[model samples]
Target: MTPPPGWYRDPHAPHLERWWDGTAWTGHRRAPGTPDVPPVPPAGGTGRAKAVALTTAGAVLVAAVVTGAVFLGGDDDEAETKTGPTATTSSSATGLPAPSPSTSEPATGVPDVVEDELNGVTFPLLDGWVRPEHVAQDDVVMTTDGTYDCPGEGSVCRHGLVVSRTVTATDQTSPEALAEEDIPEAAEDAFGEDALGQQPYGGLESHRVVKSGPVAVAGRAGYFVRWRVTTAEGPGGYVQSLVFPSSVGTESPVLVRYVFDAGEDGPPLADMDRITKGIRPVTDADSGGGVGSSIGPAH
Candidate 1:
């Protein structure tokens, strides 16, 4: 239930408090222990909650996204019919696409499926993929089997990686809009440069859209934009951004990104289609046994 109007920890700025005026977030903000000021919603009032947050929340989320960026490379796990569950929270906010509140850890024992309760979805682990052992945010990053030294020293990289999270920075719900807006950022995060400023693929140089269109995911109409990116150092890669609405909560927008190294060692691009088809609802995963059902919306 929505809490009564009051100052609460700002999801965008955890160090400060932003007013939650009953039904929506307000522009009024103050530090803890400070005297209260009458709530002053954004100039346009409560209706602008989303617009205000979209404009103001990015400063906080950029750090999270950058920090969570990792150099990609991985091994092989045969596809399995077995299924399991894993939970993760969402990040706070950043530029246009921000993060959300943290959620529970992934349920143990189910390796073939990763459940994101916060976003109300599940991602099937395709052949040669494994769930992440550790991650920086609520991201569910499924990667290929092994790791190799980076083109730059001091780190390892994976050949393929897929990450999913809730887009909490804006009230914008159009999957096509979110997908188009997110592709560049996703490409940069996965290929341009890593958290440490290391360019595992020699830093992204340029990119061209290979595919862009509407697609169904988890039975929800969504959109996807895929690009073939070129880098300065090693073999570049392909990245795609997929945005859809969560099944739970207010049906918030959810973002899923895919990164595949452009080499034979990387996963076959077809796996992208297979895994996308494998996505399902967390409840369905719990009751349906495994990922045999094709529940995602068709492209």
Candidate 2:
């Protein structure tokens, strides 16, 4: 049987040439492998064979023309079929070419920041205070000269101090509720009976609502209360507490304490004030999961 338009049967091979009809397919069929070479006409004979030969030549020419036309038309039709209405519609909708995944570009936009990382928050350390060797991960510890002068040798008499704050994820629970139950527990864990001299500061002192300020660690909210206790040692060391709420019922609230030898000549209280006020929340973009440190002087 003759194949449909745009389709051809290769007589020399067992395979069929499938055709894309712009919208659908045309079935396959067998066809002659080679073009038939027509015989030359006789000079001057109106014989029956000559007449038959002429007719056959004309039919061959017509078939050749038809075949060429069908192939050329099929080429144009196939091109249009590949780039037709559906392709245009998709391109318009997405405002880009259809994605050839192998050749596609990576996605473009701002990257997201995680809230739990604490690396972005920074505090300015007061001048003349030396950072210590045993600093905690999220805490910045420093020391200043106090009533006792720096000793010439081992374990100098200078005041020892630690300052730290962190922001961590929390639930919807109010900072007051979390602090009411959790702060005492955490203080005891970290400071033992030394946690004794707890007092309310900010709005928490009046038994009213505890107010929270912006968190330095992202995705958290709360304020810290300041507590003080004097050590029994002769150097007369002092410890100050700073505690704030974390995500409800989860991670512990951030706790920072400063310990130092008590003295009239120590650094001014203004330094501590500056550090506390400077603390603020940090986003993932700022911390990169705490891999890097934030820029600023130590407080």
Candidate 3:
């Protein structure tokens, strides 16, 4: 008999239950009693899907056109990012021609996909995401759809992505250390020190590491961190980073990351993963160069 729709133990992911979509296994699975974990997307599925996250309140940090410099940090004194939700709206994005092998046939939600030629990375961009006015340095890029006042207690934040083309090193710190400890501390030390440590600017809350564990990015072992941020009263975000495997380079990981801002119109973590998976290294940072190779004085 065809059983009614219900949760059943997943044969693939033994730890979770899989969904039987009447006709076949939908690939939507979860733990037996676990709550809040998002539905597992089916492999080779077709249809336009809005990415969702495990947490109820979460968004991502993105969209841009200008091909600019690549570096992390800025010279300007850190601005005190006000705590709570912002009233910014999604900014219009000037789309770029898809990068090499881009225009991911599978990615649909992002109409204006952006390509970073310098760093050899490309990803989908939300319709109204725009570039941030100022950042710590060129290597770090922050883009977002404006923030807004939410209907409920929290504010809808500017959802976007922050890409750090200049990550210091992968081996200097463990993957867990980089995601859980270093990333937040580094961000705070650079931006949060000013004021409103409780508040967040550019959709970033004084990020708090909520959960972390191992995950794969671009087929590489990595770390993922779910953060409980205070950008809005009830808003939050997540940061997922993967180091280039030792086969690539121990010194640096072509830092692959996703900054999700839990805004009213925020993109879900699952959607973010779809784009991150498309990232393909243009040049092998794994060959010859180890960590911190661009150190010598300019010729």
TM-score of each: 0.62, 0.33, 0.42
How do the residues 169-250 of candidate 3 rate in per-residue lDDT, one tens digit apiece?
A: 1234355555554455333322232222222333334666555566544344555555445543335555554433322333
lDDT of 1 by residue, 1-299 (tens): 12344555553344566555444444566666566555544454353212111111111122222212442211122110100112111122111222222222234465567666556677777779876543332243577777766554335667887766656545568988888877777777667655455566666789888877776777777788888988776677788888777777678777788888787788898788787777777657643223323333434
Model 3 stretches with alpha carbons more than 4 Å out? 1-113, 126-137, 140-142, 147-157, 169-173, 186-211, 231-236, 240-242, 245-251, 283-299
lDDT of all predictions: 0.57, 0.29, 0.37
Count of residue pairs whose backbone atoms collide, per candidate: 25, 11, 27
Arrange candidates by lDDT, highest first: which order? 1, 3, 2
Tens-place lDDT per residue, model 2, 177-294, is 4434333333232222211222111011111212223333233444343333222223222333444443323344554444433345545555544544444443222232131122
Best model number under lDDT? 1
| Cα distance off (Å), candidate 3, residue 7 | 59
Worst 10 residues of 3 by lDDT: 80-89
Residue 200 displacement in candidate 1 (angstroms) = 2.1
Model 3, TM vs. native: 0.42
Best by TM-score: 1
Q: After superposing candidate 2, which stretches have Cα over 4 Å from the reference?
A: 1-119, 134-141, 145-158, 165-221, 235-238, 245-252, 282-299
